[model samples]
Target: MTVNPLVLIAILLTTFTCRAERLFIGILEADSIQSIHYGAAAFSRISDLPLVQEQVQARLAQALLLPAYAGIAASETLKIVQSVDSDAPPAPDNPANVAIIPLTDDGTMIRQAFAAAYARHKSQDAFTLYEAPSDTNRAPCVAVAVADRHLFTSVSRPALTWAWQNRSKFLEAPAQSLPGTFRILVNPQRMADLTGARSAQAARIIDLGRLLRACEALSFSFTLEGAALAVTLRATAKQGSALDALLASWRVPSEPLWHAVPDNAFFMSLGAADRPDLWTPFLGAQRHRLLVPTSGRLPPPAVTGDRLDYVAPTRDGKGLCWVQLLPVKDPAAARAAIRMLADAGCTNAVTFSRLRRRQAGATAIETYTVTLQPPQMAQADKTPADPSLGHILLSLLLKRAVLECAVHNGHCVTVIGPEGAIDEHLPPETFAARPLPLNRRIGGQDPALTPDLSFGGFLCAADLVRHTVTIMPEIKPEQARLLPRGGDGATFGIVHNGRTLTASLRVQSNEIAALQRLNREGRAVLQEVFFQIFANQMMDSKRPAAQ
Candidate 1:
């Protein structure tokens, strides 16, 4: 056959340019969180490892931090760290040492808050944000912003506990105070996702009312300007017997958004904890609920190793809590454990936590607690039985605070330990003969799998990064594409350089002999420790040199 009218007008202009590129298609903009700045510098090099500082002091000694403060992530994250203080030096350039409290009051969001605090420290000399300085040898300090005059409190900010700034390293930003300079308060307030309106329609009439009557959960504390604010409600269950059976079938005003539910007053569930005189403001009545190890290399603050989403109180356990400690560094021993637990009259408190897993001297911890009773079914708040894990306890308290800065700066010590503790010695662990097939295994290597953590495996709320994430992305589909799984046998694998990425995985799974297995083997040992620390931090990129 010899067809050629210029090949029939080039096959009808490539079949109408592939049907106008499949009718104006879109959705390919997946990459470019600018790789979240190389995933926040590979989570600041796995939170400055020493086996992630004994898994961020064994998850602040076993409170098992709520999953990555709800940013969401989990392919592998097993922590409980702390073991680095041969001395202690690295954090100065002060202003009451790194404090940023902005739930809102306004000023145009504190002048756009140093452009998101300079895109979250792109030049990290560690601390500094005085501003208006073209550059005067940086760190120039002095800052403060103590406000909470309870703007007529109805839902103020008390127990919110923001991201420990972003795990750790603020040194000086919310500044102000004096004849000198250090004023960093970029206030703009309101952050439980904006509030009010009968507390957002009574938390959407008990989670879109159903057969459920008052399926409850609520926490409402007080005090402001003098700080201390808390508000929580995770599930209301069928708002008023389903608004009295939809107003007897048509009564009007049911529009809490076509009954889609979930406005639980914006959000407070993320494991609400800290009531009866609520106090979580930048935590430092004598700090160190855990986060010490100083510059052994700086690792401790994934907020207990990533996976905390926020909002709890399903049937009782309520929500909200933040305690990232590292204390024990005499302040007369935490003011004598707060004046001997405040002369044994401590009031609202409960402790029995432990998350050390394998570090201090290697393998042996992960204890847990925070139990309180009541709420036979819901709405409990008389105070006590607080077991909230809202969003998997803020994603294991920010990945055990990014594994306590990767065990005081060595990074994951071949599996979590203070590895290069050198003459100070301690770090060690091998475990993992093979394990997985249960709920909470915080640090179990199958001695029949038991160290089992609890806040009840963070009340299995679900949404694990929208179904146990498997992205497998990478692009460049044009040239008139038709790509379908370019290659095969992919239980998992992906690539992309257009930036916009984030990977902090470590996943696990096993069941040998007869079958049932699918392991990522610590995502190939943290994707070769995140590409050898992203090619030595993009060849020490202060930027520019990559020709």
Candidate 2:
């Protein structure tokens, strides 16, 4: 029997898997990434695009190889392997990362390149090692083995030598390759152990180690198909991890909340929760400007419903607007819940005042606004207020902040936006109105698999960045220029089974190209924002505490 070449390649690629003991392994198909690079450039209409293969080869050579060595044909697949000792994590002194590249040619160019670049070399039966520059104390930074048809490189000489000895095992190991242009496999158990060995300071901010402990493994892949660039992320939970327990607690909705989404919405997230009360405090706190849910000051609102949140651009195109939709068992109870939440929000520090109440069709809509109250003092004692007070006053005068609520079509709608923007997001007369096309696709059926929790959405990356820059003019011109631009937007879907969660995102080719450029050149461009945030935190920490 004869097999097609594409089918044969797929079979071979699918059969390759990493060793069970390895902490992390990444296998990338060079051809696919190269194609994505070329596709992005073409989509962006760039006349001159650098050869990505040459760039890869140059980086691998580490400033040693001359430009001529870059002419060598690149390999089809590249493997990055990192393993950690179960008892002690790998550190800089005992580094355990190695890059394995199969040779398409005899690799004479690589040997010649190293010979021309370095003064010292050591020959071995298995591979030829090239010593680092004389100025550097490190030796045997790279290894080349033409006989074995592979090139191994690592910062640690022992790692490179070990990889050379174990090249056959790595080549023959079974790999679970995802369906994409690139693939990554991570053993989270090992990662969690590694994190435990590190300092515990990060846990105070966000316990990432705890999250990692709840996962068995993770896989990620990226594919450039037709005009779209798709990314797939999959994670498997440990047998009795926290994620497993949470997954068990969730009950899949019999009917998706597609009807709640508006057709014009650019972003929407719809999900079902068996315990609707768990979200009540969060929703209420999000509305109240002063009360923080995590601070344990605000009480949970008595809102009994499954929730969905969406953001839509205002009809006038001046700014963005948002709506929180809750389809509840009792609309009157939801109204009462909102009223209670508003009451809880009003305190000596801030004032939440009722602005208006009116009837629209069969629905009764109410509006409220929040503002900071002036400090308590005698009217005769006139004193200058803080400079920040002017900004608050300006915001109130602009009518850009508002909270409105209504009950329509068996749903309680909470609108948070500018003064007139609430009217635009009022619940329609019917729930089964036209939903976004992306929502229809995500809510559609696939008999192959069942999901406990599912979500779908789309984003116009260019438009979002533009709007952000417009709203916040403080963004530097250089930083704004580094942002993504000019794409047909992207769509994504996510589904979680009892033990696993999978998400896939697809973006236009132009957007993918812009992302690639950003990854390469935008890191330095965006560091200013992080610096400013850190500076602000430092200032806050240094401030004197209240008496």
Q: Please provide, for model 1 over 1-547, each residue's C-alpha lDDT reduced to its tens digit, 9 standing for 90 to 100.
A: 2221223223323332343211110000101222222333333343232243344334222232111122212221211111111123212210012222222343234424433333222222322223332334322232212232100100101111111222221211111111010111110011121222334454422321221222222111111111101111112223344322322221111111111112221111111111211222212233222222121222223122211122222222121222122212232322223222212221222222323333444322222232222213335655423234332333332222222112222112111112121212112222123333122232232111122221112222122221112211221223112211111110111111111111111112111100111122223433543355445444533457457
Error (Å) of candidate 2 at residue 355 is: 3.7
For each candidate in turn, give its C-alpha RMSD to the true structure in angstroms: 31.7, 9.0
Model 2 over residues 1-547: C-alpha lDDT tens digits?
Answer: 2222223233333333243233232333334324534544453343122454355434444422222334244534556665543334557624366766656567776677667656777887766667665435333355555435656666655555655556665555454445555555655655566666452555533456666777666667766344655677777767986666655544543244666566556666665555534433223222334322111221224333345777777777656666776666666676666565456554644555688887776677777775655444446766534434343433433345666777677667777667767677776656574443454554343211233345566676655545544343345776767665545567666677767777777666666556555546666644654455445545744689799
Estimated TM-score for each candidate = 0.17, 0.66
For this target, which candidate reaches the highest lDDT against the unseen true structure? 2
Candidate 2 — what's its lDDT?
0.54
Cα lDDT listed for each candidate: 0.22, 0.54
Give the runs in model 2 whose Cα sits over 4 Å from its true position: 1-75, 84-94, 105-113, 132-140, 145-148, 164-168, 193-206, 223-231, 249-256, 275-306, 346-353, 371-399, 429-436, 440-453, 464-486, 509-547
